[model samples]
Target: MKIVQSTWVRYHHIDLARELHEMGHLERIFTSLPWWKADKESREQHVPRGLITCNFLMEGVRRMGGKLPFYSKGTDAKLAVIHTKNYSKWIARNLPDCDAYIGISGSGLHAGKVAKSRGAGYIMDRGSSQIRHADRILREEHLKWNLPWNPVHPWLIENEEAEANEASLITVPSHFVKQTFIHQGTAPEKIRVVPYGVSLQEFHPVQTPPDNCFRLVFVGQFSLRKGVPYLLEAFKAFNHPNKELVVVGNVSDEIRPLINSIGTEHVKFVGIVPRAEVKRYLSTAHALVLPSIEEGLALVQAQAMACGCPVIATPNTGSETLFSNEKEGLIVEARNPKALAAAFTRIADDLDLRNEMSMACLERVKMLGGWRRYAEGMVAVAREAKALVLSTQ
Candidate 1:
């Protein structure tokens, strides 16, 4: 099968593209970023047949702060909507003849329509919870925190809905994401749940924890959406003398007040480390906590598991798909500081339990089979989507 994939930004689409290339199915990839900007290893290994850069002019505009019009704080979201529309239009106009066209959600509506018209299967790849669900939950969260809520732009919403309606299949990263779409009235058969994978090559258990303190790590943006306030409260409540919280992401301005109010004596905010450095922190930490109230399947959970760090995550993070509660790690209720605290205390108090859980993390990750399996699953989905399109004819 000849497959073409397109995305405005290189999230995991490049990984998917490489997988398809390995399977001898990828015909091309349309991305906003140039090939030189992609990972050096991926570019060397799988030089895709057709790599179309769609953001040359837009990158220049971005460098000139065109997206930031008047130094506005929230203008990027609006600009992102415009960019998605532009990408959709570009793909629609330049779509290649292929057996299947897989495009990221939000930026695929027009392209999907064009692909369907050309008798090719169109697959919508969603990397997070359904947009409607995300908007509602995030808006409620912002309101609870007494902050201004910026729900997703209407243009982006319309585009996502149109893509979902037009695509032959919608692929999501987790069961949580799939349920969100079903809850929002999408047909169960229309969504495919293919959990993401981590690179064991880059993230292996290489470090031994220090004897003095038990360290907990949290990666990703420190924001309300990640349940940062709840994590702070839980960490504050946990009464361990030799414990530390290592935050390995940028602290958003909105959440800084809460961080300051909570005090960061025991917390180290190591803002945004390189991707290769993330595994180092994960390998040394006893546990990784992700108290996100909204997520697809967090790739960090898999990455942590691969590095022998047990995960403490909320159900909303789709961590249950990675490991069972109390098996590889603990699963707590989202937005519940008490539940999060209890889980933390359990791991901190019992050294043997932590060790056992860490071992289980490695075993569970082995079963998941990393990015190779993820690509194979996506290929199967593309094949199925193509078959569905053929049956209709």
Candidate 2:
């Protein structure tokens, strides 16, 4: 079961790649690095302004980082899988001979086209559906964050139709995502919901209130799609005297102005940090808030919960499958700063409730099964795809 895993974004790819490696199935990973880090190390030596002006540049940096190592390693694999539609296309020309292909998201089905051309069986990896979930977030944020009309809405609809019809197996992390595909015309038989698992060893809970300040953490891109602005707005109304919002990940230029306006006194931007450092931040936080407009099942949600930090997120975050409002964590309506603020206020005022949620968060991570289960499930899908290819041969 040799596997080539293509990671376009970050955590998801890292999670799957590491899990596969530990399971002895991972053969290679393709991805990129932070642009600023790249520029600092490259022969060019000049600082890249992308970090200061463009989210695409930031992502490009990560893609290039992911790609550089793979480029140097001679290509060899029995099976190649990609996490995104774009990566599938990029790997089509370079992919090694294999029995099957895997696409972790709907867009990734495009990789199946690449595999089909090479006489390989294609399997949909259903990571997240940007078409269905992303749009809802866009609509929610338009009102919540006072965003303008979305120009990308039409394109999202078109892609949803194309992707649903292309995949052989649609893999999802939650029923919410699977339903999104069904709504887009994919049959339920075609969709397989596999929960994205967390690494309990690395993400387990730690001593809270490590510092004097009550840290409310939000990890991920500071974009409307992430429901970042809404989180900021809600945090603004929090009125906590000794609290701080530690925002991790790179900031996009389009939203930087808004992030800055959110008030620097209470908000601290740590910028991009390595995957290893994320757990440390999660450990110190009082709570995790993901006011995302859309997501599959963000690994961060589970990571935070596993770290014993109760999560406060929206229904659309996909991790809501695990959250049992007032139980493991609180669920707020998407795009409502008022609701988000209210949830935070309650947690801020009640120490006992926060402690209970923290304990519940830890318990839920174990009951849901961790990364070991996730790896086994993904391997089964690969085996299925491989079998289908062999049967045809």
Candidate 3:
């Protein structure tokens, strides 16, 4: 089957494209950022500079001391509406005819519609929880933290719902995400849960834990949605003499003050490092904590596990698919600092348990396989969707 995929940014779609190409099914990939611009190694043929110009303009505005609409809540909502609408229209016009078209959710509406018109199976790939559920969770989080809640743009939700309605199969990364879609009234039969995979070649076990201190790491954007405040509170409450919290991501302005207010003596903010560096941190760390309130399957969990670093994550992160609770690492409840603190203490206090968990994590990753397995699963789903379409016709 000939397959074409489109995404606004160079996400895991590039990996998907490469896999499809290897399987002799990829026709072309449509992306906002060009492969050359994104990575020196990528040689895939893609529609370049689709929404890259808008991204550059937003960056320029930020550099010029203009609070670009991309940053503010209300302003960002407006920008999202404009960006997705333009990107969807572009995909509709530019996407090539193929047996199947795989498009990322928000930006897939127009392209899916166009693909369906051309008698191609349309697959909408949702990388997070249902749009409305995500928005509600974020809004509640902001309210709980007394921060400004900027709900997702209405147009984006509308577009996603439209895509869901039109898609032959809606692909989600995790059962957590599938549940969200089901809760939001999407048919369970229409949703396919294909969890993401880690790059074992890039993120592998390398570092041994130091005898003196236990190191804990958190990777991803520092926001309420990641349950950062809960993590911070738990880290603070845990009474480990040789414990360190290494945060590796961009700190949002709204969360900066809170981060500052909680003393940063033991917490190291290693802002936004490359993937290689991230692997290094993951390898050396004793445990990776992701107390996320909402997410698809967080790829970092698998990456950390691959690096022999057990994860302390909430079920919302779809971590159950990665490792068994208390085997690879503990699965704690989200938004509960006490549970997080207990999990932290459990790992930090017991040397043998920590070491055993690390070993389990390494073995778990091997069972999960890598990106190639993920690609194969996605292709299987696409073929099934295509077959169904053909049968109906």
Question: Per-candidate TM vs. native?
Answer: 0.95, 0.75, 0.92
Q: Write the per-residue lDDT of candidate 2 for residues 1-393, one digit (tens) a residue.
A: 765554444545556655676677765444444544334423232222221111233345444554665642112111111223344455555555555555444334455677656665566565665465556656666665565634443443555456556655566787667777777667888767778888787777555665566789989888877887778888888887788989899886667777777766688899999877898899889889998767778779989988999899887778667668899889889888999999888998888999999889888888878876887887787777666655666
TM-score winner between 1 and 3, please give it: 1
Index of the highest-lDDT prediction? 1
lDDT digits (tens) for residues 1-393 of candidate 3:
888887766678877776777778888776666434554425342323331222233223333443544455566567667767777787788777788889888878888878777778889999989999999999998898788777787878888998899899999988889999999999999999888877787888777767789899999998888999999988999998888999999988888887777667689998999767888899889899999999989889999999989899999999876679999999999899999999999998888999899889888888886777888888888888777777777
Clash count, predicted structure 3: 0
Candidate 2 residue 66 Cα shift, in angstroms, is 17
Clashes of 1: 0
Model 3 CA deviation exceeding 4 Å by range: 34-36, 39-72
Task: Output the number of the TM-score-best candidate.
Answer: 1
Q: Candidate 1's C-alpha lDDT?
A: 0.85
- lDDT per residue for candidate 1 within 1-393, as digits (tens), equals 898898766688877777778788888788777445654534554654345445545544555674455845357676677677787888788887898899998777888888877778899999988998999999999888888777788877877988898899999998889999999889999999998888888789878777899899999999998999899999999899888999998888887777788777799889999988999999989899999999988889999999999999998999877789998999999999999999999998899999999999899999998788998998899888888887887
Candidate 2 stretches with Cα past 4 Å from truth are 1-5, 9-11, 21-90, 97-99, 106-111, 114-121, 132-161, 210-213, 260-264, 383-393
Q: How many backbone clashes does candidate 2 have?
A: 16
lDDT of candidate model 2 versus the reference: 0.68
- Cα deviation at 21, candidate 1, in Å, is 1.1
Q: Distance from true position, residue 141, model 2, in Å?
A: 3.4
- Local error of candidate 3 at residue 213 (angstroms): 0.8
